[model samples]
Target: MGQGDAPERTRRALAAAFDPVFYRTVYDDIARTGSDPLRHYAGTGWREGRDPAPWFSAAAYLSRYPEAAGGDPFLHYLDRGWRQGCEPAPSAHRERFLERIGARPHAVGAGPQAAPRAPDADLPAGLGRKAARELAATGFDAAYYLSAWPDVAAAGQDPLDHFLQTGWREGRDPSPDFSAADYLEVNPDVAAAGVNPFLHWLAAGRAEGRPLRFELGFRGRIVARLTPLEERVAAAAR
Candidate 1:
């Protein structure tokens, strides 16, 4: 979302990182009979298109290496290529490439963590004892029953399911369907301080006390302000 030219800069950077090998293998090879050594690589499997360079803007490259332009001769060439090639392009291929490459889950980078292993459906004996004792005083409330289940709720859906089905629940209001940002295609406002249309929709829904459906989806700024209803319910139980 930054500069429109940023993506091209990034693409050139990728090309530069790989350029040293690219130039040597495709351009400077003495064994080749023709002037275009790069043409040979392109004719073979090394180059992907009419462009003489290899494709480094893909997630496959990042997935195998676990870093953006892993520190190497190839990476150095890629960085330089990104700087040189992206200057002329006005469109946003670089940012799209970054997003695609960055989306892979990894513990090391800013990416999301690898999926956690599924927890045992039955609670451990000690955890079950602790949960039972914690809820002993608050008799017959599903919300109370849920309080002892922080570990499970942190796991997300399991607790949601248990809360929905269990009787005597105190907090029954469903958390609004703010996940709709995944569905809607909307444009951003031009003003620097403009309120996002998505946030306006969420506020309008909150004012009406109507649950947001999955399609209308929230833009997240409101979601941040509204304490997750689960935390509120959990606090009330305590």
Candidate 2:
């Protein structure tokens, strides 16, 4: 191929391997860390003595499974797809791919297996260990939740129960607070459509048949979306 053609070919190949979500994740990390994400991934420039062979090669291979290239499923397809450069596989096959890489598929609702019991012990008295552990597994800081809202505990309610029933229902800033309950409170027009907010969120996403980053936030003027615990739970149930 001609020299000019090489760059375009490489671009296409990389595009195939790394979807928008991959780029977004890298950019998000950069914003969060205030560092150069491309430098971390590919170095100075594509031709500035930084070897692009590995990434380009992986991209070429990943292009074959374009259907699995973005959002949540992208991670599931990445390693094996890069190494094997094969056609897309079913969920069962993907599970096996994880196994082949010495990894196990993550279980839904499974809390951190290694989190110390100390956090649970810090929960208000009368809350059971199981309930505390369940809240922690949901990815929120359990201790922070307790400390942030003492009134829930003072009423002798389980922290998780209060979170599901009330705390999440309260409104906050749109960015970083797009919980099902909060979203409904904020978007009364949507709520007026006469559907359950939580279910509507799930149904809309399902209809699109694509991964959504629900929790939105601004990092230095850039709007970023992230999947939250409530959405994760809804996804698991679906």
Candidate 3:
């Protein structure tokens, strides 16, 4: 194949190995931490018989965003060397598995949290904007954190504190407030807190046309929706 064709071929190969269902199973397994879902799923697949090379190669894709992949079930399979295509010795799987286990976090939820309280009407609107923008710019992965809330609460610190600690001004424009609307960007776990400043802001953002992404776990496949914030507000206002 020509050099140009090589890129397309490589992309296709990668796509085939990184199946969404497989990743979903992996994420679920990790969330459960060797729970029955993983055990039952593993029993159905010929994972052991497959070459460790592909699994490991796929894991490189997963490990690219370790935290994101932490929610999947294939992590164990990834550890077993089921990568995309990095050639490895047959015996290397055991060593890699041990290393992954040793380094993995005890739980993805434990971390420092910013401790800002609620946002009264007196608080400046600019504050929320500045904080959210900064959080977004600083590799904060706010969407993902919002999705995994409570479960991933400590990861982004207190969402309210996260909003208050920024440098925003309360201009006449009234910067948007966060709400349950924005929390839906990552997952529904965030809705656990009921109503908070972050949820309030998210609701406002939606009202003003900024929608959050909603990801659903369907039998291990991740399907997302750009849920209009307005819809969330209308629903809540009812």
Best by lDDT: 2
- Of candidates 2 and 1, the better by TM-score: 2
The local distance difference test score of model 2 is: 0.41
Task: Give, for candidate 1, the lowest lDDT window spanning 10 residues.
Answer: 183-192
Q: Rank the candidates by lDDT, best first.
A: 2, 3, 1
Q: Model 1, which residues run further than 4 Å from truth?
A: 1-3, 21-23, 26-238
- Report model 3's TM-score to 2 decimal places: 0.19
Tens digits of lDDT, candidate 1, 1-238 = 4688876864554333232333344333323644444334324423332122233333344334444333332233244423333211211233332233342223455545544433422222233434543432222343533465564456564443454334113323222323223212121110111222223333342454433332212223335567788999999999
Q: Kindly list the per-residue Cα lDDT of model 3 for residues 125-208, writing each as its tens digit.
A: 444555554533443344544454443355646543444443122111112333334343222222322233343344344455
**Candidates' TM-scores?**
0.16, 0.24, 0.19
Single out the weakest 10-residue window by summed lDDT for candidate 2: 214-223
Candidate 3 lDDT score at position 130: 54
Task: Give candidate 3 misplaced runs (Cα > 4 Å).
Answer: 1-36, 41-117, 120-133, 137-186, 194-238
Alpha-carbon runs more than 4 Å astray in model 2: 1-141, 172-190, 193-238
